[model samples]
Target: MNQLPFFITIPLPDWLTERLAVPMHLHDDEARMRFVIELSRENIVCGTGGPFAAAVFRAADGMLVAAGVNSVLRLENAVLHAEVMALMFAQARLGSHTLRTGGGIHELVTSCEPCAMCLGATLWSGVARLVCGATREDAERAGFDEGPVFAASYAYLEQRSIAVVRGVLRAEAAAVLDHYRESGGVAYNG
Candidate 1:
């Protein structure tokens, strides 16, 4: 007979926790994207996870709620993408299944455009805005399979009232992806 685990835990890397221990309150999109990009770069340097990172922030004051890096390799789980991890942690931190119920609006800042699964999670995450750094082409060029995300998919999110911003700090964000590829980082889904 096969055995199945009743529960699972996705542990955050020690470096990430230590970095986030200090409070942060970014004031603009560029700053937030830059912070998220740094997290992605550090994830690569720390060898804890994939070269991607995301954070959830309170839109009103730009206070970080939670941040997470891709832990697919670290946790040995395919669904542990950066965006998913961030959302899960943010929701857990807020003690709510959806971010909408919080007193303030929330936003998700990511170092790269979300893949198909992350996009779906973003929709259900109840964040008022989704800000992306690198483009899908950038990720694909870095040997990542970003799944079937179409322009219409973004339109769908907009239709549902989720503000979407893309290509923030493009060169900087894509450079991280390039660095990861040049360093021979594993493109797990490629």
Candidate 2:
């Protein structure tokens, strides 16, 4: 018989939680972009497998519900991508499996395009929108082995009523990945 891997909880430090906490609002694209960028930087500083970060925000008010950085090393869970971690944290805070709240959708913002696992999670995450700073090509260019994400995959998200916004702050997001490479960060594909 084959054995499957399981996940264990990885608690976030109090300092990190406090540092990432932000009020919910609307029309704060710049702030949200900066938040994700900082998350990526923090991830790199922590020496994670990938310098990526993600956040879940209230769509109506822009409240940051949860933020997470890549924790494959910290948690020893290869599947715990930043987007997944953020969603997990958000769900825990909301005490619900979904991020939707009273007809308002949640928004997911990530420093880079989500890999296959995270992308699939977005579909069932109850997030109405997704914002990405860097592209999969950009990550690949930086020597990161991103999952297979074809144009049709994005189209499918749109078909499922999820709004996809790419390149919200492309250059800035790409710079984070570049910094990771320059710092000799590992790009763990698995």
Model-by-model lDDT, in order? 0.94, 0.83
Q: Taking the tens digit of each residue's C-alpha lDDT, what string does model 1 give over 24-66?
A: 9998999999999999999999999888999999998999999
Writing each residue's lDDT as its tens digit, candidate 2 over 1-190 gives 7587585568764556778665545357667878888878876775654678888888777878888888887777788888998999998888888877534678999999998889999988988899999999889988878778899999999998899999888899999899888877777775
Q: What is the RMSD of candidate 2?
A: 2.8
Model 2 misplaced regions, further than 4 Å: 1-7, 21-26
How accurate locally is residue 120 in candidate 1, as Cα lDDT from 0 to 100? Answer: 99
What are the clash counts of all predictions, listed in order? 0, 3
List TM-scores for all candidates, in order.
0.97, 0.89
C-alpha RMSD for every candidate: 1.1, 2.8
Looking at model 1, how many pairs of residues clash?
0
